[model samples]
Target: MSQTLGPTIAIDLDMLQTARERAETRGESLGKVVLDMVRKSLALRAPVPEYRNGIKRLPWRNFTRKVSIEDVNVLLNEPE
Candidate 1:
């Protein structure tokens, strides 16, 4: 027994060509490759984290220091 279905999709010509090439290289049908990619894309559990402005204030002076005396002090002071 087998299932049959027909669906219309609009894909860019370049994308289709790339998919065909990948399918040939992997010895799989283009439909299988495309479906696997779709499944993986859908199965991702985490939503992309948005960057808030002014959230990452880096210490430029500490980065430029040849030896980080401040970093050593902070590490020593951190309680278990």
Candidate 2:
């Protein structure tokens, strides 16, 4: 398995504990359970907008701050 570094994210501890217990009962890691929940939630909440082959384009393009060499290095070195 590969690993990705993530920043600290604050979540509801009570809800997280409940999900962890449920995941353990199903023989899954908490991360896997959380990812599944996120995928399901996105699917449920965001119906595909009508477009070519249901591909939803982002609203904005090239609107962020300029990317630096460090950003390119990180992208190139990211695990696949």
Candidate 3:
């Protein structure tokens, strides 16, 4: 809230679309929606990192479709 940054952060395209929808419905800026998401996410207790063979394996969630630039264009241009 005290600072602003240029468009340098990289986010998953699918998740960005979801945030855009939320911003539209809530009549908030995309950045505000994303900032709230980050706040909620950091408020949660961190997930226990899974490990295998002494190697750290970060967790992942299932995506309905593969994330790609092509997919991003479609999602951005898709009508509600």
Candidate 4:
């Protein structure tokens, strides 16, 4: 049986050259090199957690204090 292949993607000349150099250096095919890079990038990405319900609080959740122009200047260490 014939195997199915992925669709062809168009890349810029510079990017293609870079991938070719990488593939030559690693003694691997350009397709394999690019696939490896894509896999590595995907692996490094943070997985999205499933949210059950309600609002999600971020790291800067407690920084809800109101600030005036003087407060902003003070925070920036700028003179009035």
Point out the higher-scoring one by TM-score: 1 or 3.
3
Model 3, which residues run further than 4 Å from truth? 1-7, 46-80
Question: Per-residue CA lDDT of candidate 1, range 45-79, in tens?
Answer: 66555455947444334455465899799989999
lDDT of each: 0.78, 0.80, 0.92, 0.80
Q: Tens digit of lDDT per residue, candidate 3, span 1-80?
A: 67777586999999899999999999998999999999999999887999999999978989788789998999999999
- TM-score for each of the candidates: 0.47, 0.46, 0.49, 0.49
* Model 4: residue 66 alpha-carbon error in angstroms: 23
Q: Residue 64, candidate 4: how far off, in angstroms? A: 23
Find the 10 residues in a row with the least total lDDT in model 3: 1-10
Query: Against the true structure, what is every candidate's RMSD?
Result: 10.4, 17.8, 17.4, 7.4
**What is candidate 2's lDDT per residue for 1-80, written digit by digit as tens?**
98877666677998699779979999998877887877877888745555657686665458569889999999999999
lDDT of 4: 0.80
**Residue 66, candidate 1: C-alpha displacement in angstroms:** 17
Q: Native-vs-model 3 lDDT?
A: 0.92
lDDT of 3 at 33: 97
Model 1: lDDT equals 0.78
